[model samples]
Target: MSPEPLQTGRRRRFQEWPNYRWAVLGLTMAGIASTSFPITVLSASLPVIADDLQTSESAVSWVQTAPLIAMAVGTPIAGKFGDLYGHRRLYLWGYALATGFTVLTGLSWNVGALVAMRTLGSFIGAATLPASMAIIMTVFARRERALALGYWSAVTALSPAIGVAFGGFMVDAFGWRTIFFIQAVPSLIALLAAIPLLPDTARKPEVRFDVAGAVSLGLAVTGLLMAINRGPEWGWGHPLVVAGLAVSPVALVVFAAVERQTADPLFPLEFLARRGFVIPNLVTFLGHMAYMGTLVVAPFMLERSFGITEVSRISAALIARPVGFSVGAWYAGRVESRLGGRAIMIVGALTMSVALAATGASILAGWLAGVIALLFVAGVGQGAIRTPAVAGVANSVDDADLGVATGSLQMIGHIGAATGITIMITVLGPSESSERFFAIFLLAAAIASASAFSARWSPGLGTARSAGAGRRSRW
Candidate 1:
C-alpha cells in the first residue's frame, strides 16, 4: 500500500476518535517503561545474581555492558529500518522480541545466558524509541509536540526511578529471575495494545537497506562504547583497549565512505549537515553528558560528604531530581509556543549549570538539604531541555527521515552519556575525597554551560515551526 493511503486511513481513524492520540501515547509509554524496567532492576540484583551463579562482580557486570553496547550499535540501524519498512511494524516486532527475551532471561541458568538474552532484548527494544517518537511527532501538531514530548520525557525519567525504588525489594523477596518474568507481562500487554492502537507508516520497498553501512557503523559504535565501558577496568594501555580505540576510528571512516557511495545511504550526510538538525543533537549530547556524569557521582558524594549512610534516604534525595524533571518538562511544553525552543533550551542549560555549581558549593559546605535542592533544580533543567531538543530535531527533518533523525539523536545522546560517566570515573579515580566530587560537579557545570551555546544555533527559533507546517500540509 502507498504511504498516502496508509496515512489517510490513520487520519480518518483519528478523526473518528478525537482522543486516539492519547491512546497512542499511552501505549508507547507502556512499551518504553516495560523495556526499561530491567535496567535498574538488574543493577540492583547484580550481587545476588553473581552469588547465585558463582561469578565475580566484574564478570556479572557484563549483563549491563553487553546490553548497552547492543543498544548503542543497533539504534540507528533500527531507525533506518523503520523508515524503510514501517514504524508500527518495527515497533510491534520489537515488543514481541523483547517479551520473548525477557522470558528467556528469567529462565537463564548462568550469567552468560542472562547476558546474552538481555543483550538481545535490549537490541530489539531499542527500536521502540524512534518509532514511538516518530508516531508522536506525526500525530500531534507542531505547536503541541513539545507538550507530548514532555509526557514522553516524564515517563522515560520515571520508569527507571520506579524500577530502582522497588527492584531491590523484588530481588530479595522472589529472586533476580522473577523480575524478568514480571517484566514480560507488561511487554506482552504493550505488544497486544500496539496491534490496534499504533498506525503503520508507508513502507519504501524500492529503498535498499545499507547492509555494509549497518555492519561498519555497528562495529564502530560497539568498539567505541566497549573502549569507554571497559577502559577503566582494564588499564587504558591494555591491548583490548588499544585495539578498540584503533578499530573504532577505522570502522567509522569505512562507514562514512560507504555512506557516500551508497545509492540509498543509512544516514544521509546532507541531512546531518543542516544546522537545525545538527545543533539540536549536539545540545542533547552535551546536556545528557552533564546530567549523567553528575548523576554517577552524586550518590557517592551524598554518602561521603553529608554522611547519609541509609540507602532509603539517598534514594529519596535522588527522587527529587526526577520530580523536578517532570515539572520542568511539562512546563516547557506548555510554554514552548511563547518562549521558543532555543530560548527554552538556553534557560534550561543555564539552570542546570547553576544547579551543578550550587551542588558543588553545598557539598563543600556539608549542607544535605542544599544538595537535594540543587539536584532537583538540575533535574528541572534536564527535563525542560529534552522536549524542545527532541521536537527541534523532529521538525527539522522530512517526514520520511523522522525515524532516522530521532534515532541518531538518541544514539548520540547515549554516546554522550557513556562519555560523561567515563570522564567522571576517571576524575574520581579510586578516591572518595570531597575535592574529587567538587571537581566532577565543576566539570559537569562546564559541559552544561557549553550546551547553552549549542542551543543558540538550534533550529527551534523559526525553522522548526515553519518546517512543521510544511510537514502537516503534506500529511
Candidate 2:
C-alpha cells in the first residue's frame, strides 16, 4: 500500500493509539450492555406489558422465550460468519441491525410485535458474543487475554442483574418502551465509534462457507431448544413438543454427517475429539445448570418460605449473586496468571457446589441470611469459572476459528442454563414446601458437583502461556 493509504488506514483503525485495545473492549461492552439489559429488564415488566397489550401473561412470555431460542440457534452461525468474513464487519452489521430492531421494539403496538422485535434483535445481536471475544483475543497477547476476558465475563454476569434491579425502577418511572428507546441511544453511539476504533480479525475467504453444516446444525439446535423450552408449558406429549424432541436428534445426526463431508465446517467436528476443547465446554454446561436452576427458583423459595413478596426487597436479595460474580471474575482473571485456569475452574466449580448444598440446608432451617450469603458465594463460583473456561477454549483453537469455538462454548452454556431452569421448575412443580425446595436444590448441587469434577480436565492456560512466550500460545 502507498503511504497515504497506510496513513488513512491507521487513522481509521486507531491501532496507533497505545490503549486502543481497552477502548475497543469498553465500546464493545457498552454496545453489549445496551442490548443485553433488556433481556432481564423485560422480565420485571412482563405483567405490565401483558395488561397494556390486552394479552394473557402466557402469550406475552414469548418476549423472553423467543429471544433465547433465537440466540441459541444463531450464535454459532454468527460466529462462523465472523471467521469467514471479519469480526469487525460482523460486529458493525449486527449492532446496526439490532439497534434498528430495538427501535421497532420500543414502538411495538402488541405483544406479538414486541416478541418479534426482541427475537429478531437478539438473533442478529448474537453475533456480538463471539465477535467481541475474537476481537479481544486478536488484540491482546496470549498471556494478557485472561484479564481482558475476566472483565468481559464480569459484565456478562452483571448486566442481567443490573437490568432486573435498576431496570425495574426505570420501567416503573418511565414505562417499559422507554427502556428500549434509551438502550438504542448507547447502541447507536457504540456502533459509530466501533467503525473507526475497532480492528478486524483474520478471514478465511479461501475456505468455502459451510451452508449445509450451518443449516443442519441450526435445525438440530433449534429443534432441541424449542422442545426443551416448550415441554413444560405444552406438555411433553404434545405433538409439537414430541416432534421437536424427535426431530432434534435426527437433525443432529445429519449435522454430524454434514460436518464430516464439508470442507469448511461451521463447527469443526474434530474439535469435539480434543480433551481441551470438549471438557471446558462440558464444565460450562454443568456449572450453568446448577447456577441458573438455583436462580430461577430462589425468588419462589423466598416468597413461599419467608413471605418475602416485596419486589424491591427480593431484588435487593438477588443482586448479591451478580455482585459476587463480578468480584470472583475479577479475582480469577488476576490470579489465573499465577494459579492457572484448570485449578481456578476446579475451585470455582467446587465453591458453587458447596454453596448450593449449604443453601439448601439454609432454606430448610429458615435462615434467610444464610441463603442470601450462599447465593452470593454460588455466583462467585460461577463467575470464577467464566474467564478461565472461555480462555481455555479460545486458546485451544486456531486464531481463525476463535469465533466459532467460543460461540459453541457459549451455546452449550446457554442450553445448560435453560435445562437447569426447566429441571428445577419441574421438580419444584407447584409445591411450596421447604423440603421439596431443598430436595430440588440438592439435585442442582449434585449437578454443580459434576461440573467441578469435569473442570479437572480443563486445558491449562496459565501453563501454556508460561511455556510459550514469544509466539501465539495454543494450549
Candidate 3:
C-alpha cells in the first residue's frame, strides 16, 4: 500500500496517512537495509572470502566490523551534519559511496584489499543510517510519527534479514563475490530513490562543527570501539588493546565534561536530559548489545546444531524480523497515540527479554519450534521500542532539533551493539553448550526487559514547554 504522503500542503502520495512521508520512509528503509545487507551478505561469504583471498576469519570479520565502527563513529556526528547540511546531500553521498565501495569489495584480490574497500563502504554506510532517522523524524509530526517510524524501523531490520537470506542464496549458487555485487544494486536504487523524495532541509549558518568536542568523542569512541571489535582475536590482554579499554572510560568522562562546558556542545546537554530520551536510548544500547552478541552464534546453532542448510537457516532467522518489525511498528504507532509512548516501549522491552529467555530455554530442551517463536517475539520488542522511540523524540523536540536527537539515539545504539559483541567474545570459553547458551540468553533477556521499562524515562510524554530548553541541565 502507498504510504500517506509528506504533509507538504499538496495532494502528494494519494491522500495516504503519511503521504510523502511514505516516500521518504521508503528511502530510509532502503538505506537501512543496504547498510546492514553489505555486512550480513558478507557473513555467509566469510568462509569464501577467507579461502579465495588467503585470509583468516579475523581478517574477514573486518568486512563487518569496519562498517559498524565507522557507523558508531559517524552516526551522531552525521546526525548533526544532517541537521546542519541537510539530510538530502549527506544521504545521497552516503548511498552513492556505499555503492561504489560494494563494487570495490567485489573485485578485491586479497583480505587487505577487501577490508580497505569495506572501509570506504563503512564510511558511507555510517552516513546513511542515522541521517535517515533524523530526516524522517524532523519531517513527521507527533501523532503519526510512531507508526511511520515503526515501518521505517521494519525496513531497517529487514535489510539485515534480506541480506542474510540473499547472502546464503548467492553463496549456495555462484560464489561469495555475488554478495558484494548484489548489494551494489540496492545501494544504487536507494541513491536514485532518495533524490526526488528526500526533502531539502538546511543547517543554521552559525552552527559550527565542534572540532574539540569531535576529537574528544572520536578518540574515546575509537578506543572503545576498536577494543570491542578486536576482543575476539586480541584475548582482551594485549597492551595496546588494554590501553584502548582502559583509556575509553576516562576519555568519555573527559568528553562528557567538555560537552557540558562547550558553548555549543557537540551533543547538547538538554537533549540527553529528557527522561524518555535517556531511558529509551539506554534501553536501545542494551538491546542492541544483547542481540548482536547472540547473533554471531545463532547461524552456527541453526546450521551445525539443528542440521539445517545455510540458506534455510538464514531465511528463517532473517525473514521473520522484517515481517514482525514492519507489522509491529505500524501497529505501535496506533497503540502509542491511544496508550502513550511509554506503555508501548515497555511492552516491547519486556517481550524481548521474555522471548530471548524462551528461545534459549527451548534450545536447551530440543524444541526447534520454540526457538523460531522466540525469535519472532524478540522482533515484537524491536518493533515496539524502535518506532516509538524515534517518534517520541520527534514529538518531544522542535522540528529543527529532531535530526540531532535522532542522531544521538542512533549513536548510543551503535555503541551498545559494539559493546555487546565485545562482551560475547570476552565470555567465550571451551564449555559452550545449549545449557550454557541458555544462561547467556537469559542475560540477554534481562537486557531486553530493562529496555521495556526504560521507556518511562523519556521526556517525550512530559509537559516540558520549553522548545529545547532546561533539558540540558537534567542529563
Output the number of the lDDT-best candidate.
2
Each candidate's TM vs. the true structure?
Answer: 0.94, 0.95, 0.88
Per-residue CA lDDT of model 3 for 323-359, tens digit only, reads 5666667677666766666677778778777888888
Model 2, 305-333: lDDT tens digits are: 99999876887798888888888898898
Off by over 4 Å in 3: 1-18, 303-323, 459-475
For model 1, residues 375-395, the per-residue Cα lDDT tens digits are: 999999988888888888787
Best by TM-score: 2
Candidate 2 deviation (Cα RMSD): 3.1
Better of 1 and 2 by lDDT: 2
TM-score of 2: 0.95
Q: Show the lowest summed lDDT stretch of 10 residues, model 3.
A: 462-471
User: Of the pair 1 and 3, which is ahead by TM-score?
Assistant: 1
